[model samples]
Each structure stands twice: as C-alpha cells, then as structure tokens.
Target: MPVTSVTTDTEALTLTVVADFPVPVERLWGAFADPRKLERFWGPPGYPATFDRYELRPGGIAHYWMTSPEGERFYGRWDFSEIEEPDRIVVLDSFADAEGEIDTSVPSGRMTLLFESTATGSRLTAVSESPTLEALEQVLAMGQAEGMREAFGQLDVVLAELREYALGKGTVTEVLDDTHVRITRAFEAPRHLLWRAHTEPELMRKWLLGPGGWEMTACENDFVVGGSYRNAWAPVGDTVGEPFGFDGENLVIDPERRIVTTERMTGAPFPANVNDLSFDEDGGITLLTLIISFPDVAQRDMVLATGMTTGMEASYQRLESEILASV
Candidate 1:
C-alpha cells in the first residue's frame, strides 16, 4: 500500500488521507476491523501493539496497548459508532487506562475511516475531528500530523508483509499548562541541609544560581509576612549586557516545618505572583513541594510556556550536586 494523496483543512483542523492498496476491499476492512489484524498494522514501524477487548459494532469499544522502543507504554481506546462490513468504520478515539477507561482530562477526538473497492485494488480515507479549534491547533503543534503519517505508513508496510505483533505507545503529551503539573521529589539529605539549600543565601546562590551569566546582587529574607526579598541578576560573559531582576514579598514562613510562601515578580512589570514551598521529612528523605499559583489561566500558561519545569529540574539537579559535594 502507498499513500496516493494527503490533504488537511486548517480551518476545520481535519485531515484526509487517501491511500491505494493492492489488496481488495474485504482485506482492507479486515485490517482495521479485526483486533489481531489491526494490531499487526497499527502504530509506526518499530512500535508494537496489543489488543485487550475489541468489539467491532455500534456502541462497542476496543482497547489497545502500545509500547515504544524506549519501553514507554501508552493505552488507547476506540468507541465504535458505525461498523459497516467491507466498507467503513467510525469511532471516537482517546487515551485510556489499562482497564480501557478513557482519560477525560486529556484532549481526544472522533474519527471516521472509509474503505472502497477500486478497479486496481482498494482506496482508504480517514478523517478526524477535534472538539475545539484550540485543541486542534495544539495537536498539530504537537507534531501529531507527521506522527500519524509515519504510523500509517508503517501500517501500510505491515499490511503488505502480513506481519504480526505491531508495537508502539499512543501519542505523547506535552505539558501545555502549569495547572496540569505538580512537582514532587525527595532529597536524600536531611531536613536541615534541604532547608539551608533553600534558605541560606550563600548555599542558595551556589545551587540555585550555579555559574549562570547572571549574579544574585540582592537577597534579603526577613522570613515573615510583609517581609521582602530581592535578587538582581546581571548577565556575565557574553550575556553581560542583559539585565534581570526578581523581587518578592514573603507572605508566610514556618521554619519549624520548613515551609515558605512568597509573592514574586516574574521579571515582568506586573505585580508579584504567589509561590508556596513546603517541606516534609520522612525518616531521612526530605520531600519538597514548590507550588506557584497564578492570578488566572493566562498567567499560568505564560509561566508554563517559558519552560519552567525544565528550569526547576535543572535547579534541583544543581542543588543536589552541591549538597553531595558538601557531604
């Protein structure tokens, strides 16, 4: 099988794929309708697939397991709306749990596949529909179009070879919102060391700032509500001309439990945003939570769009490295 044509309507966020296969219509329909057959040709090349329950009828559902080469496993389910033998299949597909429960929190959509007999062989067309334009754009930006193209191309090859046991995980989700993420990690060091890493200006600078081009010019911590702390980072090296600063008000501080709260400016001219850092000690491991609350979804999105998670992870790694060095 070869893809004869591919067209996508941006406004509608709908993709259409037309492929010509050397097989007959019945074979093409079986490739999609039969669980075992479908799994053999599903997902991209090098990815394997497994089917749990596959019911090919209206109101029925099919659950699939896809495992990536990297050992990442993802589950997906398809709710059948129409199943016309040797002709068509319409379904609502989405990410699902192992038990085939759909994850409503994530974006998913409906799709319809049509199979027709041609003089040469068979023709197949697939159309997908998203709930919203934003969701559609998000999927497109996430590289789903290219991924689907690659996966379908692999399907063609598997069908040609009549291969068995196709494997691969479903789509990968990119964090597009801050609210959808929560940071939780444990530190092997004691609570006192963790507290010093977070609080003491000298240790903070060593781990939190590292050798970044910017230097922490001012850091005052009254450690109480109405108190203030400010840090100014002026670029060094090639970034010498860049200027950045962060100022915040300490809203809460409980040193006994190692909890702190602050309203910090995000280098923007806007008012400070709320941030809460909580620490818990379990035996010797120090569990920490850094929660940054925003005024609205827009602000949250703004912070997430800046890759805050990556930055936070890097800072934590540096902190851990410094702590290990101190011991």
Candidate 2:
C-alpha cells in the first residue's frame, strides 16, 4: 500500500494521512486534477465513484457518488477554497444527497492536500480538520483510515495508464480485506463480446474450463436478476481430478457493465460467496474486475490457497484465444 501512516489528534481536531507514490509530483497531482483518472481509484475496491460534476477552480464545487455492491449510492461534495498548481489544494468536504444537496445531518470538515517531491518519487499529505474533536472521532469511527488505505492501494494502476499497466498481466489478485479479495485481468476484446462469453452457455463451454484435460459437461444459465446458474466439469480421458460443479444465483446484472452473484460448490456445506464483477472498456480493450466476498476470512484463504489464481489465468488465456478470437 502507498499510505505509510494515518494519525489522528483529538486535541487538535485533525486527522492526517501520508502516502508515498513512485510517480512525480506533477503526475500525482494530475490524478486529482483530472476527473476521469480520479474516479478510477476514488473509492475502495467494490464501491466505484462517478463524478457528475467537477470544477477544480477556487470557489467551484465537485459532486460525486460511490455505488455500493448492492446498488446503493452514497453522495459527496467538495467545495474548492484554494488551489496552488501541483503543490496545494484546500476544500470543504461534506456528505450530500442524490440530488447533490448538502446533508446537514453529517458533520463537514476542511481538508488540505499537500504534494511534494520525495526521494523515490512523490508524497501526498492530506489533513482533515473538524470543527470539534467529536466530529474527528465520528469520522474515524466510520472507517475513514482503512478506507483511505484501500483507496490509495488502487493508485498504482491509475497513475500508470490502464492499458500500459494491466494489459498482458494474465490475472492479478489482491486481498482487499479479511473477507474480500479482488482479481483483475485485461483482455484485448470489446466489452460486450466479453460479457457474452461469460453469459452464453455455448461460448462459456469453450473457455471456462479452468485447466487442461477437463470439459464443461453442463452449463445452465438463466442470465437474469434472481436467476440461478449451474456449471459442471468432468475430466477427459487421462485427467486425474474428479467431477465437480458449482451453482450460483445472480444478485445484480447490468449487461456489459457489472454483475453480482452468489456462488457455492454444488453440494458443499460451506456458505456461498458473493462475486461482484465489473467491466470497463477503453480503446477496444476491456478490463475485468472481480471482487469476491467470502463468508469469512477462513473461507477466503482456503479458496485462494487452492491454486485459484493460476487456474483463472489459464482459463482467461483460453478465453482470449478460443472464444474471443473467432468472434
């Protein structure tokens, strides 16, 4: 993680966060100056932010919202008070409603962001000052520190151009928290086609086979909200593994944009895990992000230890070569 420290001073009614990045001060500053790049990592792993309005000049206002896994949106606004090129930015931050109306029920704070050159690259110091110590404590109790850590962890991909950073990196997995794991992979294909490859049974049978010597025997997909899907695989002639399958229900679906499902081994006794998958396309390439929420930390670790990452990479490679190539 880029964030090195997060400190809170009750007497001073301030919270400070310091993060170091391997990019220059200007480049790091551009991440915030540009709304597109800023939204890419503005929220934590599962929640994604969308900037509806962004004006960086002094006295301007920026409105944004982060959509939760269950489709709930939380709105926020920033009132710019000062800006000093690549060095400093001061804003008043507060909660807002869907219509961008300030929510007075929540405490607002003054935030100052400082950018400076570091030995390695650049450092960002963000300080948030509350009107009262109680307000500072309230914000900390809402997981502000941990949320910033997770949000900063996503900056590397944003700082580096998406394609330049992600393309050809078969499958990368990061443990966001004890129960949440995020997996990402980039494909040289359009977003809609990639969505079809995952939803259509015939197309899925061609590449969803995790490893060699196995064939997808049965694929039944309802492909709708509240729909259930079942997939089974059996080893071919010389394969050593036994037959296994999985069943899942679709919790949310948004065509080529997102899909949330609860999956579990067909007959296993363990609880089902929620898989939140999202797709982003740029310049003919699509980036697939899947965030899995396990029932507990034990379940998350156990699944990861089963060579899931390697298997997924193999499957993705097959997907690109077999299903996507002929399309």
Candidate 3:
C-alpha cells in the first residue's frame, strides 16, 4: 500500500496519485531513473514491462511495452520534457504501436512526477494532465487508478536490495479505501504450482482450511472464464462453529498469472465482491496479490471486523508449511 491517495479533478483535467516510500529521495528517484528498476514496477501485477529504449535526460524518449498474461503486448512511449535530478521529472506520455510510433487515436497526456523528502522517508506525487476532461474520464474508466496503485505496490520489492521485504511476513492486508482492500502473501513456491494449489480441488482441500479447528468439507471448482466455483468448511470434532462456504463466478482467468471473480457468501444478503487475484514470480518465489472490491463501506468494514486477515494468514501459513513444503 505505498499509494496514499489517488484523486481525479474534472475541472483541472488531471489524475493525481501520491505515494510514500520508506526510502530516501535519491533511492526513490533511482528506481524510476534506471530502466531495469522501472521495468520491475512500471506495470500492474501480471502485466510485466520491458523497456526497449530509455533516455533520462531532457528531450529524450523512452519506449516500453507491457506484456499481458495472454502474451499480448501493449506499447507506450514517454518523451521526457524536463528532468531535475532527485527532484522532478516531466514527460509526455503516449500510447504507441508495435513500431514504437505514437498512436494518436487515443489521447496522450503530460505527466509530472515530483519527489520530495518526508520525515519517514520520501514522497512521490504524480500528476497526469489530459487536454480534455473526456480524455481524463476515458483513462479513469480504463482502470488507471487501480492500475497505478497496483504498479506502485510492486515498488517495495524493487526497493529492497536484500529481497527480504516480504520473506516470512505471512500475510499483509491494506485497506486501500472504504470499499477496496488489498491482501498480499509470498511463498517459496513456483508460480505454476501455486496456481495449481488454487485451481485443483485436491490441493485446495489440503490447505484452504482457515484455522486448525476447521476442515474443508467440500471443494469444487471450474477454473475458467464464466465458470462457477464453490467451497465449504466446517468445524471439526468438538469445535463450535457452523459450516460456511463461498460461491463465486470467474470473470477473467489468465491461466497461472491472474484471475478475476465475483464472490459472495453462501447465504449472505448483500451484493457480491469482485476479487482480482494476481501472481508474480521471481526466481522460485511467488507473490500472491488479491484486491477485493466490496459493494460498500459497511460491507468492507464488516468483513475486516470478522478477523478476515487473521484467518487468511492462518490459511496461507498452512499453504506454505504443508503444500509448498511438500513441493
């Protein structure tokens, strides 16, 4: 949750994102100045970026592309207009074609990134200004805000030189806002096996159990787009808890990379929550990120108050200790 706030101003025709990191201004600036470091977090989870060309000086241009899980490449270019070392950078961002040519069909915008010192570490303020309000709205509708948040969330991994940032952290939950919550966990397992642990009923039954007192009674899954899945659990032996389950429909499935689903409690009297889950792997370690969008603030708060994060941590720990260890 590096991003503190993401706001839009229709009158100003701008979208702004402010994030704080636990590193010095120079360290934070270097992440963007270096193409290699920037590639690690330039795109949202599951969409990794590759920089073909990078020039950090004023009037220089950068060419990059992000590859989707489906192997689709989306290109982008940045024309640097200003560069003030460790302080500010201004660029014209544009959509590009395969040949790195700007695609004027879609609107391009001017972006300004400001780096400043904070008591804890440093702060980054990024503003993208569109020429028209319609252009701003179009970008927002394309999930720009959520994409920016997810991209920034990956910075912690890149900034940690020792690569021990999330090692043994169990599970971390961040409340992004009134209706959105992001959960992250890392495991010493390959991405494909981690995907299998989630898609295969047999593997899921082994570790999806929340706490020690409960056991998964049934596990059913249709791991494909537009497919349905249901999972149930009940207390074991003398444990005093009723059976509970969740049912969801898969909205998008990107094989071992990502999954988006609409989930709801078995008999809850509320709207479904949209869950966007993504997996990113480095070496043999896999990072699992789940962003849940609740119907409203009340529903979000209710779920959190139920010790949801604690229960998830227990399940994730079991996953690592039992399933991952065996692998």
Model 2 clash number: 0
lDDT of each: 0.65, 0.89, 0.86
Q: List pairs with backbone clashes in candidate 1.
A: 47-167, 47-168, 48-166, 48-167, 48-168, 49-166, 49-167, 66-168, 67-168
Question: Tens digits of per-residue lDDT for model 1 on 1-327?
Answer: 277666778787787777777778887887787675566447643344678898889999999877543335678899999988878899997889988999887688888899999998888888877888877787678666665665566455335521121112111223324543335556666767787777888877766653456566666677665677776666667864556567777655556333434455546766555665555454455556455556667777776777666656666777777664576
The number of the candidate with the highest TM-score is 2
Using lDDT, give the best candidate's number: 2
Residue 206 in candidate 2 has what lDDT? 92
Looking at model 2, residue 57 earns an lDDT score of: 94
User: lDDT tens digits, residues 235-292, model 2?
Assistant: 9999999899999998777677788888999899999999999887766778899999
lDDT of 3 by residue, 269-326 (tens): 9899988787777656787888888889999998999999899998888888889888
Name the regions of candidate 2 deviating beyond 4 angstroms: 162-164, 190-193, 280-285
lDDT of 2 at 279: 85
Question: Which TM-score value belongs to model 1?
Answer: 0.48
